[model samples]
Target: MAESTLGGGAQAASTSLKNPRTAAAVRLGLAWLIVGALVALAFSLHETPNRGAAASFSLLIGVALGVTFQRGRFCFFCIFRDFIENRDSSGLFAVLSALAVGGIGYAIVFGAFMPNPSGRGLPANAHIGPVSWVLVAGGLAFGVGMALSGACISGHLYRLGEGYTRAPLALFGSLVGFGVGFLTWHTLYVEAISVAPLAWLPKTLGYGGSLALHLALLSLIAALLLRHLPELPAQAGGKLTWRRIYQAVFVTRWNPLVTGALVGLIGTFAYLRVSPLGVTSQLSSLTRTALNNAGWLGDRLVGLDGFAGCAARVVDTITNNGILIGGLVAGSLAMALFTNRFQLSRLTVRGALTALLGGALMGWGAMVSLGCTVGTLLSGISAFALSGWLFGAAVFAGVWLGIKLRLHA
Candidate 1:
């Protein structure tokens, strides 16, 4: 939580970017070109190994996203931090802007064209899936835990991408927590999610009505956030200010809205290529595999599919598994290289343990609730699910309580 850590990284990354050194720029340009070429080639190779192409594409995307995320230091936890501790709204603006862009895009794609990935019937949109008591409880727990852990699931990924040694500890704990969640999956589904009512904007209000409502709500939140930001002083590092706030929302330099939209578009295109956006499930799947290999889980989880429940398996496969999670790590690494600051972080035992505990809570809470903040909150909102809004509200409340308790401090 030291501003210096966030501050130093940015100055370092920026200074490197602005460096007049020809050799460094050449290196960066080459890397970007290589990544781009690979993407093109991968898409063109209709006859090549399809699965490998998907994985490779995913890995490449991850690399790029990681670098951007690490260098940009964009994160949900920080957004909330600015709001709770600093009363700044820049971070929130980034989120809203991204959602705004994404919403407009999705409205065009799903609302009108109704083209499926293959130009088939429109893919089943999940603005909000079934909502239940479990969602509220689980989301609240995950949000509070994120504050304590200093990051949410996605936040942890970006930190790890930046070479934060503590992040892997949190990730490992998340794996264990996922395992525990799987063990309890039966009770959770039978008593909670299975019985939950599926919420959708299409049913209550037409798609047009739903989209308008969402846009207005998010816009209102953004306006309220704007009002709170002026109270904060601009810090050289991570502090929020009106200028930075404007930059976050309006500046094309690195708008969160644009970033999130690109991610959404990529996710949508990824659905074209392989799947929709998803992150935690793949990790959970990977964890399930590891646990099964270790004889910890039996056949119950082996080859089990959440696809039936999620209904966007292809998007989930590509977005969650390949892009978001991998993109984070890749984004950070790419950024570090540009900055010439690629080094593993060192951390105290206490810090490591704290991350681990926090990760466990996040992983478990996410599973019990059926998604993380990004998956459940952001994506769900774009889909215009009432549950998504509720989950987001719960997250804010939890963050507030955590800040009040000074858990982050």
Candidate 2:
């Protein structure tokens, strides 16, 4: 009887392995195991003596950001494209919500750090950049790049984990572009950026006034965009179950407001603990390091190190930004796998060339402006910098022009 039972169990196990559903279940289980291992690695890194907690924390934050970006479809270019082509403003609300929430959170933190906003001193590491024609030009170029590449810098990073075939080329092009920016930095810095004003709202308006104005502007924008928001179709009511809850949370795209609020909270905490949320520092650093090592770039980039936005410097070790980016990609990959969304895309010559060109434009823009959309626009506005507003406007205009010209096509 024992021998018969052992044989029967073996047979059942073999049959299960052959079943398609069981195979899929096995794959998903493996994916989850990989994710769990990554989480464990993060904890292990945190406990390491030399690595410290910051690296681990940055990794975790990056993972959270990755999951959020993927689940919410929080690509800036995608959001703008939807608004421009489909007349859908629902995604735009996410941006407004994030800015509003982040602004409030920043105000609280700023109050704690520097109670007197009227003083000349500014918050440390906040994304307050100079306002100038260079900034506007950067924004325009970045926007056009987004349209051509079908994603912004951050978007490309996240999508890279989603099996985007063109992302690698785009990123390489960005490196080249950064090299080009390095080449022109001295001229641009001396000509325009040197004289640009670094305008902080809190310097003039105080924290309370600045926060109020920020909310008011966001409210006004939301009101204006309300007309463009399409009414979503209502879902039929169904009995709630654990499985249903799981499906809702894991399978479907998240609500925009919820996504935005979470992002805002993350940004706030990230600023409080690590630094302002920016993605370009490591990329720029890598480009700079490569160029410098090859003896192609100059020894000094004029006024580059003194800037307030994402600081790109020659680095010998992995910084927090590097850890964050790694975590982001890993988290995104895990999420993509879990959702069965990780499929390799077909690559074409046209697609590759466009991605490279677009990425180069974006990289140059980011380098010149001292940040990308995520850095100069989102984080900048959250910090109450006028440059953020100016950059945002220029980007919008650039996107509009690109769309009109069918550049994205």
Candidate 3:
């Protein structure tokens, strides 16, 4: 009787596996096969990417990063929360580890690829040109707003794609922040931006030394990760194993470091193709154009003339305008459908308004500081830019304070 029951159970399991509705695994397997073919096709193309193609490559990298980040549930805010609230270091380790790798990679690339590493590096935009006190203040404001909004600038974008009903409001607030940024740009140019201290890695220590330092830092972060891993209370039926650890490390998709590096590569390509690693300028330029068309302010800002002109070449795809924006939305939406996690949920009215306010602050911060968390902090840090570090420090402080104030609590 026992043997017969065991056989029946095996038969049921087999039947379930053969069900037509069980399409996910089949689809995933087919995707891998197609990916293999596409990779082969790319290799067959047999042409080294020029600067222009490299820039396009960067866009593709950004797309990959977006997909990875979405699937991994990786975010700076979550990283900090993991440490502060949950006593978990995995998320933070992921960020710092990625930073270390990306930082070293940037140093090597810049040191080797650039005509003059001491000056601006290969892509003129990659330079950590200078630092200003205003950056510290701006960073602080942005951090505070991010906490209150319950999302950062990039956070809102990704979350928006995840069906966060409040994300749009947050983004709208960010636009207003950009407007505020425009209002303050003139003062910033004179009082803050021009005199900000220029940061150069080679000047402080030679390229090789800096790269070594970055690698060492990465090792230290990994060590910290080992020591500080959180002990999550197991779910009622959960069993821990190598597979579970693997799932935790990689989640359902790509790693954050790879995504970030790909983003950096895309930045590298962007430098070769059109402009720098920036999103605000293009958006700001668009804002300027719209306002001008409405008989609003023009000839007032540095970026306005270009948007007003809408010159096809520069105004088109140069900045973070097109690819990052579109790819993030697309990646998130696609992942949602794939994972069966799509849902539209609204926050409290207060929370919704807070998101908007926070978003506005982020936009303003990005505008005044010349970029947002991704552009200014992540990309900037990887490039060894002083502004990036300062911005990071400031943002962290602000988040701490915001939490203390219970803004998002």
Q: TM-score of every model?
A: 0.76, 0.93, 0.74
Q: Write the per-residue lDDT of candidate 3 for residues 1-409, one digit (tens) a residue.
A: 1112212233234346343334344433444553454344334423544324443444454455556567766566766656656667767665675567567667656655674655533345563534788778888888888887877766666677678787788888877777777667767777766666666566566677666776676678678676777554455456888876655443445554555555555555544444445545555556545555666554566532222111112233344355456556555655554553445775788988888898888777766666766677766777766677788889888887887787877
Mark the regions of model 2 whose C-alpha exceeds 4 Å error after superposition: 1-19, 235-240
lDDT (Cα atoms) of all candidates against the true structure: 0.63, 0.85, 0.61
Count of backbone clashes for each model? 25, 0, 7
The positional error of residue 386 in candidate 1, measured at the CA in angstroms, is 2.2
Error of 3 at 315 (Å): 4.0
Q: lDDT by residue for model 2 over 23-99, one digit each (tens)? A: 55665776688689778978898998878788889999899888888878888888999999999998889899899
Find the candidate with the highest lDDT and give its number.
2
Residue 29 accuracy (lDDT) in model 2:
76
Model with the higher lDDT, candidate 1 or 2: 2
Model 1, 1-409: lDDT tens digits are 1112322333343446433344355546754664575456445543355455676566555555465455445577788888888787767876786566656655666654453333432345343455877678767777777877888887788777556787788888877777777777667777767767766665556667767887898888877777775544443687788877755532323645556556556544543444444458677766666766778777564222432222212122343364446555656655554454555777877777778877887777777666777677766776666677778887778778877888776
Residue 328 of model 2 has an lDDT of 80
